[model samples]
Target: MKAINPKTKTNWEAIGVKPHIEIPQTNALDVAYKMALNEVKKSVSDEHQIKDINDKLEELSNSLPLKEK
Candidate 1:
């Protein structure tokens, strides 16, 4: 590696400088992929439960009185 000189260059040393080793960066795509997988897992688990929730919401909405107020 070429030696860096403060007088000849900027006063900062920017190469190979890490305070601590960190985990590799995961970008937005990685986060989105994980979230989608989680949602799919939840949706696939006990489909009857999801159906029951939808049925209850439908019943509640149907029983409500609509007003133009």
Candidate 2:
């Protein structure tokens, strides 16, 4: 059996090859931690974007003239 290259999705090693490029496998806990970290990063990014949009909207509202009813 030959190990397949991840990038090109082809077998770079010759047939009956041993000790090819080793691909590190992650455990379930490691995968879950990475996924949670990504979600947290995305959430923080979304919060900052929302805050910026709100600030811009408030500035625009303040600049506009209001009329008495």
- The CA lDDT of each predicted structure is 0.49, 0.50
lDDT of 1 by residue, 16-68 (tens): 54534232353334434444555655756587766765565455445444311
Where does the lowest 10-residue lDDT sum fall in candidate 1?
60-69
Per-candidate TM-score against the hidden true structure: 0.30, 0.30
Q: Residues 1-69, candidate 2, lDDT per residue (tens digit)?
A: 756779867885555435432323433344344445545555565777657655654554454343113
Clashes of each: 0, 0
Identify the candidate with maximal TM-score: 2
**What overall lDDT, based on C-alpha atoms, would model 2 receive against the true structure?**
0.50
